[model samples]
Target chain A: MERTTFNALDPNSNVGCGRGSGVEQGAEETIFTEQASDDHVIIKDSCDVTVTTTDIQAAVNLQVAIQLAIALVLSVSIADGSQAQKIQQDLLQRISTKQLIRQKTYIENSRGIEVTMTDAEASVSIQLLLQVLLALVAKLDVL
Target chain B: MNESDQLANKLGELLLGDVLERNGFTPSSKRPLTPEQKQQIRTVLENLQVETERFLQHSQRTIRRESKPNH
Candidate 1:
């Protein structure tokens, strides 16, 4: 049987070939040996490689962040759809409820003259109508 | 938010104070809208009314389309 055995004599060398346990921290050493007989070896190989867990984790985190950003943008566009129309309708309804359709009472005075009296609930209703209209215009202008 | 939206927010706040004061309520500030501001607001509202009508019509059409059954 023909046998070949090689041993790496350098342990602290960074030249990609080494033996012993000083090949750098977190490095994995793989050894392969082929034996033709009980005392004869045909081929042998050894390698030391460092595995960077931080780099792999960072790459995974970046991929997750990208997916989250894409999902956020899609959700925002869908949620904002028809938002302007709803805002306009809400402003209009505010005016109608606050000012136009408020209840009032007509009371006869001591001289038999009828007096139109607005309820306390409707006191400030029509006064804020202009402000609501202004806001509605501003919203529609943006749209 | 964009510049226009920021401006609209500030203008709305100012209008709120003005309306409160004019309606016999005490406001946070005493700054009422000037006559020019009032006129500008009125003009904008007039223009927006036409657009609002068109928008409502378009929205109604969209609603009808979405409610229809697919063949």
Candidate 2:
């Protein structure tokens, strides 16, 4: 059995991103992770597991990034633009795609149950926010 | 119908209904939209497409950042 440790995390390492263009840091970006995990991944499976330290970080980073991006869009002056209605519909379409495919998540091996649970909760919150935004947009879409 | 199309249609209908009611029209009235009204709808569609593309890019970037390993 491989031993796992958490002393390799580099908050500045950039994870899987290679000098990525530019990371616009928003408050929400750091809301999930104040510090990156220095954890060394060691999976017990005979086969190599896909979830690594970077994967876990990326997952956390992605969720926050998406949250911030949506928030930014919603906070802009065009918050209630007529197009919002269509955009909301498009978002619904995108969210629905989750039901069409089954993804074998590595969360079980890469992260703890708490992180997985948090992700689920975040997903539900995001969906609810989208739905509420769309409802508001529908009411205002008319000229 | 595909889920995406169904969702798009449903949202479109809600928005369209509001627009029509405000303009003194109804879905069952079978009245054609004026040119200006049509233009407004087109503008909204275009804007949505642009924003959708941008959001997709953000998502792609996130995936790229997460998928590659530093080692």
Measured by lDDT, the strongest candidate is: 2
The residue pairs found clashing in candidate 2 are A6-A38, A6-A39, A8-A38, A9-A37, A9-A38
Query: What lDDT tens digits, residue by residue, belong to model 1 across residues A21-118?
Result: 44444433333333222221111222332211112222223333323322222223222434323333433343343222222221110111112222
The DockQ assigned to candidate 1 is 0.03
Give the per-residue lDDT of model 2 (tens digit) for A1-143: 98533211223322321233233232112113322233332222112122312233434443444434333332331334444444434544444323211123332112111122123332333333333344433443422
* Regions of model 1 farther than 4 Å from truth: A1-81, A93-95, A98-116, A119-123, A138-143, B1-71
True contacts kept of each: 0.03, 0.00
Off by over 4 Å in 2: A1-6, A9-143, B11-41, B57-60, B63-71
Per-prediction DockQ: 0.03, 0.11
Task: Compare the candidates by TM-score and give the number of the best one.
Answer: 2
Candidate 1 chain B worst ten-residue window by lDDT: B60-69
Error (Å) of candidate 1 at residue A19 is 99
Candidate 2 chain B least-lDDT 10 residues: B59-68
The TM-score measured for candidate 1 stands at 0.23
